[model samples]
Target: MGKITKYLNQLIVGNVFDTPEILEAYSTDRSVLKIKPKFVAFPESTEDIRKLMRFFNQIAAKEIPVSVTARGTGLDEGGADLSSGGLVISTEKLNRMLEIDPRERLVRVQAGITLRELNTALSVSGLTIPIGGHNNDTIGGLISNTPVDDSAGKYGGIESFVERVEVILANGECLQTSRLKKYNIAKKATEKSLEGDIYRKISKLLKTNAELVSEMSKNPTHDYSGYPAIVKLQYKDTLDLMPLFFGAQGTLGVISEVILKAVPLSKRPSRVVATFKELDAALEFAHKVKSLRPRKINFYDLKIIQEARESGKNLDGVIRKLEDGFVVLVSFDGRINSCVKKVANIQKEFPRNTKFIFETPENRLILNEFENALAAYLNSAKSSERVPILTDFYLPARNVSGFLKDLKVLEQKLDLDLALFGSYATSIYSLRPKFNLEDKDFNKKAATFLRAGAYIIDRQDGKLAGGTPEGRLKAVVTNTNMKDAEQILYSEVKRIFDQNNILNPDVKLGANSKFTLTHFRSTSLPKIML
Candidate 1:
């Protein structure tokens, strides 16, 4: 047998599934892209990863295209397409906590460990990872994407908590990268003209400094495109590997293990719910909180508030309208004693009319129930039919109010149903009325709205927000008019980390690439060719 076949069979303990069902399952992410892998391999341990890397190295010797793709919970940016054809290295089986150091306030876990699992494990030790979003994300995936959510203002993000990382390179070399040793490796990598290694070192430096910039620009959430800018910010002049992988999105290498910093478990947890009359009013309040730089801040629109109320989730009368067609919620969480004082301070900035709902333990239970029911309710509602698309964009935090005004104007111009919501400092998402009908008129209208939105965002120096582009619509929406050199930043990074273009080769960012199957199939990639 060929070396690839023999190595995979002999060294990996995980399952290898080549069935059509498995391929279909692995073909798409939450985002658009649709190429399928020739095979899927599930590796259970670092040893299994070592075996797979050896196999990949052997395959690389032949110079055939290959890439590694993985999902913590299958959350992707679009059309669920896997535009690259290669082996899908599934990390699901490699879920184990190697160490938890309470004294150092760090934990080491295998790539497949989900946030929920890690948090639960940490709970036993009376500690917790400070940053997480939506609960289901994998530790590896979060590190790869480097998301900073509610706690970003204070604790920073997944990237900040990352003390060290173990990764397998494109050629199957296992390397352990940390802050202290980053410069040495980076210096050598740079001297050797190794683009991938150099980028990794630079990224680590960037991550170190991202917290400061991120705090100031907190109003509209930052982008997590080619890689987290934090990597460059923290280690821009250093050897930090952070830049190489922060936004590699699993292209450069597989993160086998990570050591992350954690916060002590809150002995007394507290929650504060603040209500606003108008969306603008809530936004104004968010700006102040951003100035104070609180630990966590989340905003909920009227639609979500209504869902919470109607479902009889513990949020009874939690959200009442101050004006027509507007609702807002601000939730604050922290340690009990200090949290009360912080909430008091936050309340002073708001108008006397603003309502406050202090969450008891019972209220917390209700909030969970309400949030859990929200996804289903939104999915089933006919109102969603009116909004066919949701688009997100972020500018500097200070520019958010002006941006929202422009958005409202677009809503009026398009005569489309629209709702906007997001974290005050980090991001804002605009939801267009769902169009359930399959008629050409609906598609055309949706397209028009999307084009208009994209145009406005482009004019404001915004690119697509949230996830990767999946379809033609996403391609157009995210396509930037940036000059070739600027665009190459993304493409060059992609080429370096995803050298063979093996990992999700179809998802091109910052460039003028179309999101489509035909685009992926084409030999020569063009800016707009689909």
Candidate 2:
């Protein structure tokens, strides 16, 4: 441990660990990268982060190149939340539900509170944040990534529910979006404060480049890479910096707390699975079902069904009912009569050969299993020596079929086994390719396939990273596709927030950083068995 580590341990209210075992645990995430941070600090309060930031700034004059990376549940892809060799601040200890105002239908929570914990607490008041089941992910991580989930078509993402956020900037200054009070004359006094200065600077940047900002905002794909272009998305006229932090992957600042808009829990939730003999037919049905505005619409192929069966997922009954082509699953939440009416309307628009399966409460559990079984099954299929590279591509709904075709071409061209999954409603698909790191030939082939896929997505004006931030693997593509003006704005924003580039440095902005396959953990056997 160094002097800084010792000082952090002494100052922080939470525990600081540099033990090999603990360091190893925090080294890697779901991504194919493993670089143990020098020290991992578990912070309990915002004050602790503030003090640490102040110390970091104080030490900056001494020419110490200390960096900070914050993590919630460690479920990120591409190692965006991982500190290469810097300090890792785990917000797990900061988990707390600060307040829940029933009247306003809003909840204020500490950043590290998990979705599971928040939903459990909200259940008491019959309220919920319908951002889907990222039960293991903390609120901070979820907001930071802005992931698209099963319920995204219905409730949208974290941005839909997030009303405000309290962020701790790099200089130990705290800024709150909800505290701006846009129309209040007292805001002038606040302008003189530290938070006010930040708000003003960012607001001016947005206003000055209004036209370019508008053009960038037109990107339909869901992206959490680089600085969030939040000028017009969150607010029409006034400034709302909360969206800036959303999907920033902690590059901008550390989220301390979030005040989210909550909705009442639906009493009658139901799901229905529809099967089609053709993939195009399934997609057409999905388009029609969108008119009814179903809570979620997910489409799976025969490969997914086969994988689930191989993994012993008990999806045999469902598979038996499915056609040779594709299956579309649609979920609805409302009274039984209302749901039934919507299903009837959906069936009318479906092709004559289409088969529909209405899921009972019992069957719903099985449907959930079917939905989640493929990823586990695919992992089981890969050898222990092979590392899985799950790449997310997002495009317009019309281009989904074409994108799938391109993926098929890449699979054949690369001679790799690729599995597809994700939210069809949002036209975002996850391409999971198996790679053996020890085999140099396999690594080169996988890289070629990824580069080709990135080109395809870019051609369609799609997002290379849909659900995850662009870390080492996808950063090259993100940097390539980013416009000159957007790049300039992102750099300026990053400079303003993280002046020293001490927060997740080079992960997003450093275009020169090459994507290499050497840092991942080596395994002789697969972690999962079929």
Candidate 3:
């Protein structure tokens, strides 16, 4: 590393830190895993990244075990940003909004820009990225994980919002990817560089398994286990390779910049904060909202509300009575008349006695502030940590009641006191059980809970990697649970762009239970952003 460090000092514009303190600091992400990187590089520009990648590619060519993981904000609950005994490439310094075309409704920005900052800038243009409900995350991180968007019900997955992506390939070649006609793909395949090789091999493989590829192209319930955008690799005569690269979790390529298709901000927004005396009614309304594909719909079950109350958190506006029922907050954004009519139509489907409020500043401000309740649940007076296992999974709309009952039974069996809540619009649920980390058998219990809960989700037509992307922590769950053919296809895709597996190994493709158990941290030491 001494020789490598010296060479890197002159390689690029950004800082290179291999100090013990820096290595220890960048070791972990939001996930409970700590892997001290041999070197952490903060590349300042696209050229810097390409130089670093080229240098690493040369190192890997020597039969050395060198892997690289990209870091942006380090908000990953999954181990997508962790690399043991390798380099951690931080995109922090590259954070910038390059261009905004209000007329074209396109925003080009560095991938390291935080969602909050991007939205802040886009506010002037009345545009915003359609994915990510959280502000603390970076565009690069979101693009890699492709987590289920809170507003996915309205604007499909990230693919719909992403116009083009600038990716630095494993061998440091810069390739700008977008939808291309078959002839353009053919032209790309004819080139002799790494980019050309990727296009040739991926296009060939996708054509070979065209039917399976086509099946995976459907974005019904986006799977974070494998490539989520495997959907529509080719539509009609157009072929796009971004699907193979974007959500592969930096295992395939490093994203430098992203050109996003921004949507118009809602001028007139209407919200409904409804409390249900019965869970059935709330769930029914939630499904209706899901069908309507509104901008926002969040559901907090009775357990969450009760937990909030027990934690000494005031829910004066949100939950009036701490009883066993559901609290739903659904909002629509558009013209005032359209929002009103849509709200009225959904309301008509329910009984006339439904408790409802138009959700105003003067009225109870519950819908927008319930995140504090979730924080309360995690930081209850008790010392138990809210274990992240069983956090993100998709739930089908049909027979949700029976599936929920099974969840309750599972909760009781584990004695972990699970709380259910998440974006109802996406039908994604977060079930984090409270458990004391100091317990001797904490890891065992978490593993058991994760496996059993994932089984129940699959059995009930639900699936893992819905809300949370399957980083290293849940890789054991998502990878093992995948269909055999799907696994094979993902492997081939990994081989195409990342032939040497030099990019972010032991992640989506190379993940195993042994690595998960070995690397998972106990107290979750987070990386310090530069």
Candidate 4:
């Protein structure tokens, strides 16, 4: 091992692994990228991370190409947190709830704690973070990924809940967003203080580029691809730097701790599935149901339900009851009486031809299973040689039907099998395509298909990759679509935070970055299809 690796082993109290087995295990995430890291360090505390950052700085000064990336549960769709040959800082050991202020309705936690664990602890106070169905995801990962939940129309995502965060800069110095709140006109401006310097610089940048920021804000997408539009910085009267880290994908700095706003748990929750015989009709009904203020509104294509049935899981009772068409699921949460009243209101407003399947408390568990089974069934439907390339994007409610039609046309033109599912409330949809990665010709065609799909979304004035942070795949597309002003602003912000480009290098900023299909783990498998 080199000096840096040896020093990291001595500094971190947890564990540092360099073995082939461990490296191989950390190589791939949910995406198809496979780049084995040179060293994997499990950090147990913020102090360890400080030391690691300092080491990175030292190596970077010596003209070494060393970089660092922090990972949570590795549940990301793409390789946002994955590194090729750099230091991988695994924050799993730092899992701890530092403070829970029930009165303030906020919780301060070590970034590595899982969502499930955090909610379990908060249950005592009858409060919980409102992120949906990602119990296995880590808090840090969720913050970085910025995933939109089923209830995004109601509660929004991590961006809405995050109060503040403590991040370690590229220079090994710690910076807290909470410090920005402490800044006042009465205090003398000190160039010596890092926080003060950053605040002044960012404030000036936003003030000078007010017009550009305003223009970019008009067409905001749920995409966490690059630095968020600077318009978010200008709050009511002052600037808030917390939103900058929401969907940053850890490119700015390592998030050490976060303070999230906690909400009271719902007293009673209810869900109903409304089936429609036509896509256009289901979409129209979904827009009307939005008026009822449901906690979540989700839509699934008929193929998803068909796949579930083919698995022989005895979904006949559920499928037979519904019409052969698109399915929309709406959920409401509050008092039992209020939830019931809301359901009644939805029924009255819904189209008369639509079939409603109200799930009672006794059968609610079954409904949950049915909803979860769709994703599972789609995964099993893929052929052995075919790899899943799932892409998510957002559009306005009025454009969803047109976008769906475009997707159908694209499928026919490319001769590929595809499935769509996601949050109807937010109009954020995911396109899952099965590609034979082993065939070079097929891979080339798949790339063309993605580029074309991106073009379609752009024409619709929609944003690409809404569900997760921009990884290699979406980064290329986002970069191509970014205006000159936006690109320059994004690059400037990246340079300010990570001057040396040691943190998640080449992600969301670098000019030479390219999205390629050669780095996947499946490349090592035999050419034969399973």
Q: Best candidate, lDDT-wise?
A: 3
Q: Compose the digit string of candidate 3's lDDT tens values, residues 1-530.
A: 48788789788888888899999888877666678889999999999999988888877888886889999978777777877789999998888999989999989999899889998999898887766456867888888877776777777767678888899998899989878898898999899999899888887787788888667655466566877566657788888877766567898889999999888776545677677877788988787766565677888777787877776666666555745777787767755466656777878777765666676666544644554676676556355566566766888767467778888889789886766787777778877676666677777887888788888888888878876667787788888778898889888888887777789988876887887876655663322311
**Against the correct fold, how does model 3 do in TM-score?**
0.93
Displacement of residue 23 (Cα, Å) in model 4 is: 1.4
What alpha-carbon RMSD in Å does predicted model 3 have with respect to the real structure?
2.7
How much does each candidate deviate from the true structure in C-alpha RMSD? 6.8, 3.0, 2.7, 3.3
Q: What is the lDDT of residue 71 in candidate 2?
A: 92
Off by over 4 Å in 4: 179-189, 193-196, 321-324, 335-353, 385-388, 511-515, 523-530
Which whole-number lDDT from 0 to 100 does residue 282 have in model 3?
A: 90
Better of 1 and 2 by TM-score: 2
| Model 2 regions more than 4 Å off | 179-196, 218-222, 233-237, 321-324, 344-353, 361-365, 382-390, 515-517, 524-530
User: TM-score, each model?
Assistant: 0.78, 0.91, 0.93, 0.92
The backbone clash count of each candidate, in order, is 58, 2, 3, 0
Worst ten in a row by lDDT for model 1 = 521-530
Question: Per-residue error at 83 for model 2, in Å?
Answer: 0.4
Give the higher-lDDT candidate: 2 or 3. 3
**Could you tell me which 10 consecutive residues in candidate 2 have the lowest summed lDDT?**
521-530
Alpha-carbon lDDT, every model: 0.57, 0.73, 0.77, 0.73
> Model 1: per-residue lDDT, tens digit, 203-270?
54334445544553454335544443432434344445554566456666778998888887754435
Q: Which candidate should be chosen as best, given TM-score against the real structure?
A: 3
